[model samples]
Every structure is written in structure tokens, then in C-alpha cells.
Target chain A: EADIYQTPRYLVIGTGKKITLECSQTMGHDKMYWYQQDPGMELHLIHYSYGVNSTEKGDLSSESTVSRIRTEHFPLTLESARPSHTSQYLCASSGYRNEKLFFGSGTQLSVL
Target chain B: AQTVTQSQPEMSVQEAETVTLSCTYDTSESDYYLFWYKQPPSRQMILVIRQEAYKQQNATENRFSVNFQKAAKSFSLKISDSQLGDAAMYFCAYRSAIRNSNYQLIWGAGTKLIIKP
Candidate 1:
């Protein structure tokens, strides 16, 4: 089983609320990624980190930001949430390039 | 640019029957990886099977098997004795094997598999 974890399995917040989605893994993986997905849709990569202190934006443009201060932790924060930001956020990690990714349960965020 | 295509948006099959999900990819690189991932409702995504470009043999795991035609750039997943647990959104992904590449996977839109009991 994958050791990755994402907190707040489901979240409902009002617009303009600042929120943070937590992601952590115990497998000591060097590559961590955050993807946004809608119901019955393809996953869109939002952010990824190769290792500590390294972060890059993905193909999809996202208003959220992420920080990789530690190998096990990568958190995404939204300064001001909007209804457009409501979507399922998934966290994944891989040990090496081209390796299969292990995913977390995902956080479903809803902004009212 | 590499692209993965899953033409079937949704597929249905009777329980205990067999079903196939089609996937095609466009890539110029000869060496790369292909993957099948399953996402159950309100659950995490998990790897179901994978096929390497250079491998002539198709990859199989338990009830799941892949028909990989590298020449046609087609990779299809076939599930035997389909079960209710197999109902989920299946995604096809492709990753380039070229060195120095970021190793990001290009994903298909996904196919929703429904097993009718």
C-alpha cells in the first residue's frame, strides 16, 4: 500500500477564505506532485517538487502555491479561495523517474 | 509533444464478463513507458498495469492484461471476469524515457468503467 496521506478528505469553505491542503509521505520519495481533477475528467498537474527547496509549475495554470521545505511534506496554499478553485486535489509521489506513482486519498474542496 | 488518447469516455460490461478499454498515444521517442491507473469513487488512484516500449511481451497482473501494439501506438487494457470492484475511472499515461527529461506523464482524459451486476 502507498504510504502517502492527504488531510481533510473533504472541505467546504466560503469564498475568500485562505486554505491549505496538506500532503505527506513516509516513503522518502524525492518527487512529489499535486494534481487537480474534476469529476469524470482528466487530471491536471498543478505543482511538483523534485526535492527539498525545488518547486515548479505544471502545464495547468493554478492560483495556488506550494512549498517543499521538507522531503516528507508538501503543502498547497491559496491566499484567497474562490468558487473556481473548488476541485479535487490529489497528491502523489514516486521514487525514481518513470516509476509508478503512489497516490493519496485526495482532498475534495468546495468553495461556496 | 506527446499525447495520450482514450476515445471511450465510458464503458459498461456485465459482471463476470470481459471488457476492453482502448488507449492510444502519440510520441516520437522510441523508448518510453505506458501505464494504466484506476481511480475508484472517492478513493486514491492506483497503478493497475504498465508496459515498457521496448518489451515485446504484454504486461499482465492477475485479472488485468494489456495488448500493447507499439507499432500502432495502441495500448489497450483487457479485464477478464470483470467484478464490481473493477468499476472505476481508468486513465492511460505516457512518460518519455529520454535522459534529462522532466519525466512528466502525459495523461488521457480517462475512461469510466461500469460493471453491471
Candidate 2:
């Protein structure tokens, strides 16, 4: 089983509030990714990390920022949340040299 | 940049029957991987099946199988003896073999699979 985990399964907050979504994996994978998805829509890659201390922006533009201080942890933070940011965020981890992504349970965020 | 396409937005299958979902991609790299993932109401994306471009033999897992045509850039999933538990949003994804851009997954707008019991 995939050991990737995402916290705050669901969140609802007012706009301008700061929020952080936590993601961690116990699988000792080298690569991790953050994706934003709307209900029934395609997934948009927001941020990704190849290893510890390596974080890069994905194809989609996102105001949120991510930090990879540890290999097992990659958390995303939105300094000022907006209603437009309301969506499901998925965390995934892959092996050293492959693209077979193992996904998390996902966190659904709603900014009011 | 590689792109994955799932033209069918929604599909329905009767319990105990079979169904197939279409997926296609565009890529310049010859060695790549194609994946099918299922997302239930719980919102966990589960890997259904996988196919390697260089492998001529198709990939299968239990009742799920993939028809991967490298030349056609087509990868479709066929579920046999469908069950209500199989109902979910199925996403088709692609990744390159090249070292520089292998980390990214090119995703298709998923197809929602509804099972009629």
C-alpha cells in the first residue's frame, strides 16, 4: 500500500486567512508533487520536489508556496487564501527513477 | 510537452458487464509510461493499471487491463465484470523517460465511471 498521507481532509475558512496543507510519505521516495484539482476536472500540477531542499513550480500557476525541508514532508502554504483557491489538493510520491506516482487521500479546501 | 486526452467525460457500465474508456497522448519520447488511476468519492487516486511504451505485451491487473498502442499513442482501459465498487473518476496519465522532464505527469481530464447495479 502507498504510505503517502495528507492532512486536513477538508478545510473551510474565510478569505485572507492563512492556511497550510500538510503532506508526508513514509515510503522513502525521492520525488514528491502537489496538484490542485477541481471537482470533476483535470489535475493541475502546482509544485514538485525531486528531493530534500529541492522544490520547483509546476505547469499550473499557483499563488501558494511549498517547502521541502525534509524528504518525507512537503507542505503547501497559502499566505492569503482566496475563494478561487477552493479545490482539492493531492499529494503524490514516486520512486527514484520512475513516474509511477503514488497518491494521497487528498485535502479538500474551501475558502469562504 | 506531452499531453494526455480523455475525450469521454462520462461512461456507464452495468454490473457484471464490461466497459472501456478511451485515452490518447502526444509525445516525442519513445520510452514512456502510461497509467490509469481511479478516484472514488473518498478522493484517493488509485492506480488501476500501467503500460510501458517499449513493451509490446499489454498490462493487466485483476479485472483491469490496458490496450497500449505506442504508434497510435493510444492507451485505453477495459474493466471486466464491472462492480459498483469500480465506480469512480478514472484518469489517464503520461510521463516521459527522459531524465530532464520525467518528474511531471501529463494528465487527461478524467472520465467518470458510473456502475448501474
| Highest TM-score scorer | 1
Model 2's alpha-carbon lDDT is: 0.92
* Clashing pairs for predicted structure model 1, backbone only: none
- Go through the candidates in order and give each one's DockQ: 0.92, 0.79
Give Cα distance to truth, residue A53, candidate 2, Å.
0.8
What is the lDDT for B86 in model 1?
Answer: 98
Identify the CAPRI category of the predicted complex in candidate 2.
medium
| Stretches of model 1 off by over 4 angstroms after superposition | none
lDDT of 1 by residue, B36-114 (tens): 9999998889999999999999999999999999999999999999999999999999999899899998999999999
What's the C-alpha lDDT at position B104 in model 1? 94
The candidates score, on chain A by TM-score, as follows 0.98, 0.98
Q: Note the Cα lDDT for every prediction shown.
A: 0.96, 0.92
Query: For residues A48-96, what per-residue lDDT tens digits would candidate 2 score against the true structure?
Result: 9989999999989999999999989999999999999999999999988
